[model samples]
Target: MGLLDNVKSKLSPAKDKVSHLAQKHEDKIQHGLDRTAHAVDKKTKGKYSDRIQSGTGKAKHAMDRLAHKDDDGGSMSPPPAGGATPPPPAS
Candidate 1:
């Protein structure tokens, strides 16, 4: 396999583990994200309120993806047909 494929293979197990954990503790994780965002917003006295809110929203969206919350039957869906490229994974 190529270097990128090799690296992805090695990380697959860890990714699966993280996905499982995220699914199991989704509520708690979301709550923690909200609490942290609130604390940071308060500490900054609303100077970075917009940015903080945006970041928190992004984070929650990522967590939902990791948990596969959008998937039906708790499994990943197949990629679309017509050779359309899938979106890159979230950073």
Candidate 2:
């Protein structure tokens, strides 16, 4: 295997672990995201409400994808169209 394939193979288990953890704590994660967004919005005095909401929605969608929880609560692969593009990590 090429270096890329080797790297992917090595990382596969870690990725699966992450997916499992994300699924197991899906609801708590969702709640945390919502609560965080609300707190930030409040701190900003609604100045960034739109952006905050958008980001929150994207985060929830991503968590759903990671948990293999689709709209119908059925397992699904990563979204075929946009894919599960995570946002840049916060500094």
Candidate 3:
């Protein structure tokens, strides 16, 4: 396999584990993200409130995607329309 494929193969197991954990503790993870964002916003005295909020939203979205929350029954979602190959089916 090519270098990128080799690296991906090595990391796939870790990625699946992380996805499982994220699915299991999704609520806690989201709460932590919100709390951290609030603290950072407070520290900056709202100077970057908009940017902070945007980033928090993006993080939460990523977390949901990782957790497969957007898919039915927690199955993997289809690949994006950008012509990338989908991940292999979970064993």
Candidate number with greatest TM-score: 1
Assess every candidate by TM-score: 0.76, 0.72, 0.75
Q: Model 1, 61: alpha-carbon shift in Å?
A: 0.4
Extract clashing residue pairs from model 3: none
Q: Candidate 2 lDDT, tens digit per residue, 1-91?
A: 8999999999988978988899889889987887788778777877777788778877877777877743456555443444222333343
Winner by TM-score between candidate 3 and candidate 1: 1
The reply for model 2, stretches above 4 Å from the true place, is: 69-91
What value of lDDT does candidate 2 attain over all alpha carbons?
0.72
Ten-residue segment with the worst summed lDDT in candidate 3?
82-91
What is the overall TM-score of model 2 with all chains considered together?
A: 0.72
| C-alpha positional error of residue 69 in candidate 1 after TM-score superposition, expressed in Å | 6.7
Model 3 earns a TM-score of: 0.75
- What is candidate 3's lDDT per residue for 33-55, written digit by digit as tens? 77787777777777777787777
Model 3 bad stretches (over 4 Å): 69-91
**Model 3: how far is 35 from its true place, Å?**
0.6
Please report, in order, the local distance difference test score of every candidate based on alpha carbons: 0.71, 0.72, 0.72
Task: State the lDDT at 1 in candidate 1.
Answer: 85
